[model samples]
Target: MWAELIQEVRVAQTGVQILFGFLLTVVFQPKYGRLADTDQAIYIVTVVMGACATGALVGPVSLHRLVSGHRVKPRAVRLASRMTLVGLALLLATMTSSLLLILRVATHDGYVPYLVTAVVAWYVLCWYALPLWARRRNRGGSGD
Candidate 1:
């Protein structure tokens, strides 16, 4: 369980690290200054979310390191799993906000919000719904 959790965290950690690194550089770009106040606010929120996601995704490794010698593998695995979930959620928010900001700046279309909504729904379905559905569908029959 711990190994599986670590693998999952590794994937999320890499993605969030890349995103946070990119977000950190955005502020120094000359075009950043030309953004409208609302866009600027969105950028700030997105950056913060990216930071949080990075931390949550990276937390499992730190947690494991600190608790390694305590003979608490089960507890550590549970906590790591929770952190990964939070990280994924934060990643979702960060992506949504980033998309919103990009679309708003690229094209001030009235359909921006609707499009973002559709994409978010798709993300939720892909990231969470399918796995949950699979679990529920196979729960009893597998006899694990």
Candidate 2:
């Protein structure tokens, strides 16, 4: 379970790190200074969320390294799993905010919020709903 969790974290960590790195560069862009106050605020929030998501996704490796000699694999796995879940949720927020900022800057259409909301719903369905449904459905079977 620990190995599996680490493998999963590796995938998430790569994505969040890439996103955070990109977010770090946006402040240096020429258009950054021209953004509206509200848009700047959104950008700040998105970057912060990206940073946090990156940290959370990378936390498992750090946790393992620091506690390597200890006999706490089970507890560590539980904690790391929780951290990964939080990281994923933060990643979702970061992506949503990033999209919102991009859409707000690209076009001032009134339907942007609706479009973002729909995308969020789709993410929730894919990231959480389906997995949860499958977990519940298979709870009584031998899969566990």
Strongest candidate by TM-score? 2
Q: Which stretches of model 2 miss by more than 4 angstroms? A: none
Global Cα lDDT for candidate 2: 0.95
Give TM per candidate.
Answer: 0.96, 0.97
* List of clashing residue pairs for candidate 1: none
Q: Write the per-residue lDDT of candidate 1 for residues 1-144, one digit (tens) a residue.
A: 888889989988888898889989989999999999999999999999999999999999999999998999999999999999999999999999999998999999899999999999999999999989988999878643
RMSD of each: 1.2, 0.9
What is model 2's C-alpha RMSD? 0.9
Candidate 1 error regions (>4 Å): 141-144
lDDT of 2 by residue, 1-144 (tens): 988999999998988898889989999999999999999999999999998999899999999998888999989999999999999999999999999999999999999999999999999999999999999999988865
Tell me the whole-model lDDT of each prediction, alpha carbons only: 0.93, 0.95
lDDT of 1 at 80: 92
